[model samples]
Target: MVSSAAQTPSSSVEQARQEGALQTALALNRLLNPFKIEVKVLGSTAHLRGEVENEVERQLAERVALATRGIETVQNDLKVNAELIEQPLERRAYAQRLEDATLASIIRARLLWSTHTQAASIEVDSREGVVTLRGQVSSAEAKELAGVLASSTEGVYLVNNLISLSAADMARLREEHQELIADPPLSDAWINDKVQTSFLYSRNLDGPNIKVATQDGVVRLSGEVVSSEQKTIAVEVARQIRGVRGVDADMLKVATKVSG
Candidate 1:
């Protein structure tokens, strides 16, 4: 009879390495060719590390990792390298491109949660403008909203959605999200809400000047935190909120006016 005990991680790790090199090779191909990035795959996780020309390349790397067979998740450590730009003007242009991508993602996320729309349940995470979506929605319509919102964002490089829904539902959700983007709402109260809450509750950060505002579910945290660790904690707090889809931490920084 087979034993009920769980296999040790070490044993599992060895098993994966011994299984075949095909998995590793395929992973490399996907990262280098289509995504144009270097990847290191071990067991079920893929580490995407290296410098990319812009945010788009950074996100493409993550998507390729997810598509590769047997990959459970991707650890994205891709950096945006302006130095890769051959010309000085090109480097500035690349920075602008990344900035646009980030801002777009923020706007889209805010629009998504601005109303009591059918997509109230989704969660969005935007980092340097790339959107990573997570959480459960009651229907496919909600899932599509998650994607559409991410896509519509100005600075968005890619949308990484981990939503669960039936095939039929997924189609409906996508359509709805698209419609909202095409005719976005004037006010984004929901997005502001998500941003505010993230800073207020994040354990990874603390600060005195911290001010949080949320519209719909996106949060904007502005203020002063003494240390980088505090800033991180503030962001984490926003992430924990249920309906939050995005967080803007630009306002968080070390206070210069205060005396030590």
Candidate 2:
């Protein structure tokens, strides 16, 4: 029989969600929430405490905790039940497996550090030496290389590559990028606007600040040219054939007179 707490509340759905989580947590055993794990319920805010077997489990616990009716926020205090200092020698074995999988997925063919390349994008999950790779890659070479790199790493018994090509296929990926200049959809414009805003706000230069403008499809950059490097970068990036158009830089006037 369902408890009274599980019964549908006359309140809003959000309130129901908060109530549901608290009821569920109370029903579960201490091993589930543990002593270190503290759960706080403040209207819609949910705070979580304690640790779990792995990150996946930690996240799962958070989801369960949030199911309660009034939870607004969740603060996770769940530590990864590391095998080193804790009990149950079996946990140590499991930790080693996870560590190995993380290492294998991040290792490149010849790169020394796992972080040097874009390994963070790749998700690694493993049971023993079996590793599962989930993500997208642009090239067949990249796909094949991903597996080989994972297999070559120590402790990886097998690799399951779940990579799929993005919408931009290999043959036209480079060329298709150029079309952003001719007719941009709203999404493209929003992205460009964000980039331009960030660039303008950055404090990396000192002088008569450069000006950047975009119209219809063309980009016009006007300001005192600081250096050949800056001029080259401005022209190339502002009107890159990929997303933007021809660079109209004639309006730019290099400062020829010093301020008195």
Candidate 3:
């Protein structure tokens, strides 16, 4: 029920993905300023039309689009106000650290504005080019999203996410974790069968030693592997399979028989 490459969008599958990409970009924007914008979707490409204050904001839009899972290319049609104040990158090499600090501030400001993040509790640090995020977040997804935001910021070269849940949140997380492990929705026997077959077909793995299970959309890989490398590969295979929302590899162990 899909069209060929040369065909029109007889189906809106690609269109939907493009729309999703646009929504992600808008969410990331947080609209700190009054600069109006428009988004257009063309196949796997994201077209951005807007006016921003400076080059940083201009590039921020492209970065957000590129970070989106479905967007392959971003066309930034953003106009920056020529009179706007911006850190002149053409300054001497000594100003490099200052630029990094500005990028960090931009990241922190965005985090504070995002509805999905707890920016006040999180500590942001930028040294040279790397940004380190510390403090507590509500969940694993929030932690990951924070890292994504930091890394996608214009000047960040590296990210160290040290955020964890608070004690109260941890308690709540445990209850959710228990339910998640106990039940998996949108998952069924077919996905389980596919996961097992994927391992069996993998040239690098021994599927017989790895047991695969699926619930809802979560995939669990248990049993044992001959080496740590094989264990990692097995987990990755399960993660790549369709219908898998999360992966549980807690029970997977590397065999003692294998030498380090």
Candidate 4:
């Protein structure tokens, strides 16, 4: 048999490992991750201390802790406060920063994929939904198109276009354009993702209410929109995506308002 001293060290290590696993399980839960919840494990019992939005959430946290493997009992010491439902200011600010970064990336990809603006060297920056475009384009039309694309993207509240017209390298521009043309066709999955992203980013469309599917370069839209004009706009948006051979919006219907 192993000595008691040896067993003590091994047991301690196992307890620490179990503590870390319990903490991770709590953090991964969407409802509990935002709150500052503390977990401590001793033997087979887990201790939880934190503030949750309500009793339901408190129970949820306890259930999650108990469900963890090796955790047989949970000492739930979480307090219920309605105010805890509101996210902390730091969390909100962090989320905004992430949104701005994502918006900038999307606009840059849009410019790169557009045949008219792809050759132009454009820089995109976004802050709190406002986008700033800078760089040089070969012509006035290209510069204007870049600004329009940036403004139309979802989450963009405003656009500041500072692109200037300049004489571009003709040979390099030609080579880039030819490369785009020679590239292989986009896959069906790629087309579907882009189309869905376009709907989500469009300011005038109800993105969540719309469903998009693509097969063989043909896009099929099924969803409800408030007006006929919105339906038409949805079809046009899908058609404009790169590699989309056709858009079929026959199934997309206009929602009739109910009398109050």
Candidate 5:
């Protein structure tokens, strides 16, 4: 999840510094392109290692890493394979496309399981090594966290975060969340409709693969999800629905090896 920049080190100066550096490293992950990027932060400087598609991607990685809060310098040691540079354009493009698609899937799954962001509301798309995030996010912290997650994905060259806030009125949203806890929304029927709708629209959820049933404001999730992450997200989404008194996931089935 996203948060405001760590304050200038105070009494916990050393601790803050360490955390800031780690955060900066995590933010740089989205710049990776088909190769694992390792980040090591030392004070205000970050060391970047691993392989990249080309000099351009390597430079882009460093630039993006520098933009992350709490880092001023980047020590780039990203190596570019010369053999790939000589390959035909179509071949290179095909390889990149395949890698990008895989990267997008992994990133989307991670976001779904993230505690800091609303995975259902965020959409991940990748093309030509650039990742784009679109859809609605509830809070600014989630928005920032989404971007950072995209940056850290494998084979991601550039990230364009365009997830807008769904709620323009944060105060109203906070009140609604509070009110739902105190006095659920409407009735069981209303809650069921909203819960099912949320699942149908989620980016990471396999909607058709799962079933939703509600009675007396109790949500019961059944059927199968591709991953444990999806199962977790499904439960969280149901709970977030207004008027949900309780959620029963015991009936929900998760496959150990889901492939489609």
Candidate 6:
């Protein structure tokens, strides 16, 4: 025997709770999160009000509301506006970040592979196509070479070379070089990575279009270049890498032009 007056307040509280739950569900949905949606609940029926990118999103919002624990029905009052949606800016930002990381890796590999800068310690950072080089090098020549290699990389727009000459670092590097000379030959994996990176750092070469594979101390190049000179440069770059016994470019070919 509950009084109607008492039942009114209890019913209102239940409606509010249901509305909150439904709104939370909509907000957490990937398709609906980007839109501003409003939810209202009356008894077991939930009403959605807002604009969505398309009919799919409208239906999705209604479906989400209906799936809530206390909602048995949905009143989808959402309007569709194709103009409400735009390309996600975060995706472009993520792509830029990935490019910067790859640029940094290529610069580091170039420094390590160069005979003049091989023993030098350097740090590379890239952002929006600008590269920054830091750490200590044995000579001004080494510092300048590091900058040149970074600036010459395909994706680099500018280089900030902050490498300083250090006598103590030079001594340490010389010792490390001697130890490296006593060690075994560079692994095939190392040679493969360096050769690919070198291509990226070298001008007039299409690094991404070229394929490189290493076995023992030999590198095999296979891919298309715009010209025969590019093909020759590809072979020379691979042969210059330390511990590379030979380069086989039999599969490398120059791209043929079609008449327009």
- The 0-to-1 C-alpha lDDT of every candidate, in the order given, reads 0.57, 0.52, 0.68, 0.81, 0.68, 0.82
* Model with the higher TM-score, candidate 2 or 5: 5
Off by over 4 Å in 5: 1-184, 256-260
**Model 4, runs deviating above 4 Å:** 1-96, 113-115, 138-142, 169-174
Model 4, range 4-112, lDDT digits (tens) per residue? 3555877778778988887887665555666788887777888889788789889999898888888898889999888865665566566567667878999998777
> How many clashes does the backbone of model 1 have?
42
Q: Please write out the lDDT profile of model 2 over residues 175-243, one tens digit for every residue.
A: 533453255343445434632542342233222366666665466767777666566655643442223
Tens digits of per-residue lDDT, candidate 5, 1-260, equal 11226434452465356445554544434434335567666566667787666788778877777876777877888788756544445655555666667678777765654545533467789986689999766688778877866775545678999988755545555554465446534677776776765576556677777788888778899998877888888887677554677899888888877479
lDDT for each residue of candidate 3 in 205-260, tens digit (9 for 90 to 100): 78888998888868888998889898887776676554567789999988887458
List the RMSD of every prediction in angstroms. Answer: 15.4, 14.2, 13.3, 8.9, 19.9, 14.6
Q: TM per model? A: 0.28, 0.29, 0.33, 0.61, 0.35, 0.52
Of candidates 5 and 3, the better by lDDT? 3
Off by over 4 Å in 2: 1-195, 198-208, 257-260
Better of 2 and 3 by lDDT: 3
Better of 1 and 3 by TM-score: 3
Candidate 2: 10-residue stretch with minimal lDDT: 109-118
How far out, in Å, is residue 106 in model 1?
21
Q: How far is candidate 3 from the true structure (C-alpha RMSD, Å)?
A: 13.3
Selected candidate, larger TM-score, 1 vs 5: 5
Model 1 compared with the native: what TM-score?
0.28
Q: Candidate 6 regions off by >4 Å?
A: 1-102, 113-118, 139-141, 197-204, 208-216, 248-251, 255-260
